[model samples]
Target: DQQVKQNSPSLSVQEGRISILNCDYTNSMFDYFLWYKKYPAEGPTFLISISSIKDKNEDGRFTVFLNKSAKHLSLHIVPSQPGDSAVYFCAASGYTNAGKSTFGDGTTLTVKP
Candidate 1:
């Protein structure tokens, strides 16, 4: 069974709206959660991240929330722009696992202009 999963294959939103992507994980060892955004032909870029010790982390227009009790996490993009259209992936890893992560398939977000 997959350790991490993003149920929504895709999402569409109007410009300046909020887009929320959800992720669920089955592993309890995950202590760090990360969100990455990827564009065609480009490597995934790190967005925001949250530690199991904190409930949320935000950077500019992006925000990541984690719920350890539920083994779930969500990413929120406020004022979503067309340029934000891309595939978002949720990743989980332990402190000792540093560079290694258990990643969700990915959620494609289409932000219309």
Candidate 2:
């Protein structure tokens, strides 16, 4: 299912800069939008998330913005460090069954020092 899509396959940025990742979804039933960062040999680690009730949410250096009308979302990481380099994934889930999540193809980000 083309429920979610991450158009960018990869991104590169200098250390201490901002890293922005984009995501799009076709389902309007989605209630949650989340971003996860996965390093090699490890599972995806949750970064930030935004609920359908909220347009934007921020935690420390990470921010997640959701646009319900357009079915689009984005994750922003400020002052990204080299360790932040990884495969970032965008996932969506409906409220009816939060456990049933649909994920987009991940975008690999390289933060060069």
Best by lDDT: 1
* lDDT tens digits, residue span 14-111, model 2: 99999999999998888988898899999888888888999999999899988889999999989899988999999999876755889999999999
- Per model, how many backbone clashes are there? 0, 0
Each prediction's whole-model lDDT (CA): 0.94, 0.92
Models 1 onward score TM values of 0.97, 0.95
The TM-score between candidate 2 and the true structure equals 0.95
User: How far off is model 1, as Cα RMSD?
Assistant: 0.7
lDDT score for residue 77 of model 1: 95
List model 1 lDDT by residue over 31-67, tens digit each. Answer: 9999989999999998888889999988999989888
Q: Candidate 1: where are CA atoms >4 Å away?
A: none
For model 2, the superposed segments whose C-alpha errors exceed 4 Å read none
